[model samples]
Target: MHRFKILFVCMGNICRSPLAEGIFKHMTDNAARAGEFEIDSAGTGGWHQGNPPDPRSVAVAAAHGVDISTQRARRIAVGDFDRFDLILALDRDILRNLRKIVPAGETDKLQLFSRYARGIDEDIPDPYYGGREDFDRVYTMLLTGCTSLLDTAGKLRTS
Candidate 1:
């Protein structure tokens, strides 16, 4: 089997995107062989560049027994277009922004994160300025989406 690289994207790397990255990584790690898939995330902008995932975001993920304390904020770069097999955006705006940067040949690799969600209409909401509940809600939403994503990616990997 071949290893596939996935990049999660959002307004900032500190919130939704990192949560998705952490959740997806955990699911994939427990499902497939040691190196079947890789997950990472970055922001559309560099506002939080060099920062760690938000305190609430880390706390929420840790509460669920997932550690996302090591994630650092980064802005999406041109090289990321080539590095990741999938460039997943948290919302329509980020998807649109990604579309502008991805070349024609690679556009198919870019997508809305909800495409992997099983039965949800809402994308993961950013929890930068909200309360702890917001982070908790995003944690749940991404848990569903990332698990679904891992299922699909794992299937593609096995078959």
Candidate 2:
């Protein structure tokens, strides 16, 4: 009955991380596995804390039948290291930032999100300053990665 907790992180919670949180939630709900997961998103910096996700991220997620408008931005916290079973970073830089702050014994919780993706091995680029095409590209990558992550959750559960 334990829920598998996950936290998606980015430089700012407005763009990439929020999108990832929404998409993963949508996927889990669609599969009727929503009850088995606890999902959320955060940023490395608190500049946008308490603000909603960027409009572009909301629009793109809406276009894909997911709504991320209700999510609020928040900076990653030390408590999060203990809260989530997995802490996924959108890029290598974020991964490094996470490594620096993660508690010594909790280091295993940090990971690069793309590792779950089937073919993609690169960092997920920040699309905050770009146009719709940029958001679209990030959406595609997240969809693929989230699907893989869900597929692998059984292993996480067993472990």
Query: Among these predicted structures, which one has the highest lDDT?
Result: 2
Q: By TM-score, who's the top model here?
A: 2
Tens-digit per-residue lDDT, 1-159, candidate 2: 789999999998999999999999999999998988999999999999999999999999999999999999999999999999999999999999999899889998888999755556689999988999999999999998999998887468632
- Cα displacement (Å) at residue 43, model 2: 0.4
RMSD per candidate (Å) reads 1.7, 1.3
Error of 2 at 31 (Å): 0.4
Relative to the true structure, candidate 1 reaches a TM of 0.92
Ten contiguous residues with the weakest lDDT in model 1: 115-124
Give a tens-digit lDDT track for model 1, residues 5-73: 899999979889988888887776676543888778999999999999998989998998788999999
lDDT of each: 0.84, 0.92
List runs of model 2 lying over 4 Å from the truth. none
